[model samples]
Target: MLDWLRVVRMADMEAVRWALVGMSLDTVERAPVGVRAAQLWVSRMLQVGLIDRARPAFRQGSVVWPKDTTSGRVPDLFRQTARHDLAVSAVSARYLARGYEWRRDRRPITRRDHQADGVAILGGQAELVEVELTPKTPIRYKAIHSNHGERLTREGYTRVVYLATPGACRLAMKEADRWLFRDVRPRVVAAPVMDARGAWSGEPDAPWAENLMPPAPPDDAGTPALWEGIA
Candidate 1:
């Protein structure tokens, strides 16, 4: 839990629960104790000062941080990016449950000027994962994709992935389909969170492919691929 918190840094109580749920993902029984246990353990940790939460915890989008492990300026980004970052954590939680080796540095800046959300490695393929809760300008997309494209050419990455929410998902896919470069095209899929303090709605339904993009995996678990020749 500390490792996930340190990597993700500042997540709300519910997002933390989702991460715990991912760790509790069982191939045999699929125990949901992660949800139940999250509250208990977190409260206990607060009492013992192993962790901390936004005061009066019932406030809208109350978040928590690893006070024991945190340093520098305290969680200032919590207010601005809580919704987006928690949504990203939801996506990461799903990946964790699916057995992907997903990770990012505590600072989360993959490149000097370009920071993707996280990267997933599985089956010897490295996927640069981006969570798009809102759309960016087209020109911004052009520049970002250009940089991401360069990564495909030189970096060890196999492909890029845009895990967008409902509205943003379609735009991400449209942009990918319109991309001229097939080698660097990204796989855009739906990854919606169920409102504030809610769970990820698109859990366990993976690699949602359209028109010959490989069938969706069974409900148990599945891996999302990086962009191939899927243009």
Candidate 2:
């Protein structure tokens, strides 16, 4: 099943498994047809004891694998809200469309010491995509901006795009203005939060309303390619 889905690594498989938890078949069907076939693959996984499903109060049921199946730590399906899941789905869909490989980098950036949601790599460059459903306190935002502004170049990211709710995007843009005085290099662009259905309603040419500067030129070296090694 993993090979059929082109899930090359255990980590990527785990990511797909976690993202599918509490997500409906309709939502999964939004993925490109080849990937959307997860509907049937998931059923087979359940039969083979590769995954499990649990019903939670006040929410849809969730699919999860046994602790021993991958990471020993328990999955946090209970703590995840619908908005959070939608954000993940939205980003996943975007990366999937672009044919960028996904990595679940739960670790903090070495230079900034801030944990990004995940990293997507196409070829040479890596993009850090941050999904913000709710705005953080001013102090927290300041810290994030300060760290990212200082370390983006040193950390080797091509750019950092913040996908957040309209209100949160406004706050992020306001904070980005402060970077002008500091002379941050890596571009920061803010796009609207994806809908619950994981679709973007914004214009295709310019999805971002707030950008510290013009969007960076495409990384020609970072052209889309087949998925490769897993971290």
Per-candidate TM-scores read 0.70, 0.63
Question: What are the Cα lDDT values of the candidates?
Answer: 0.57, 0.51
lDDT of 1 by residue, 24-108 (tens): 6466122234555777878887888767777433334456777754453466543657567666776665565455666882342
> Each prediction's Cα RMSD?
6.2, 9.3
Which residue pairs come into collision in candidate 1? none
lDDT of 2 by residue, 46-147 (tens): 788665555445333343334245554544554555436545544654454444555655566465478766666766667677777777877777778776
TM-score of 2: 0.63
Residue 147 deviation, candidate 2, in Å? 1.5
Candidate 2: residue 61 Cα off by (Å): 6.7
Model 1 CA lDDT for position 138: 68
**Residue pairs with backbone overlap in model 2:** none
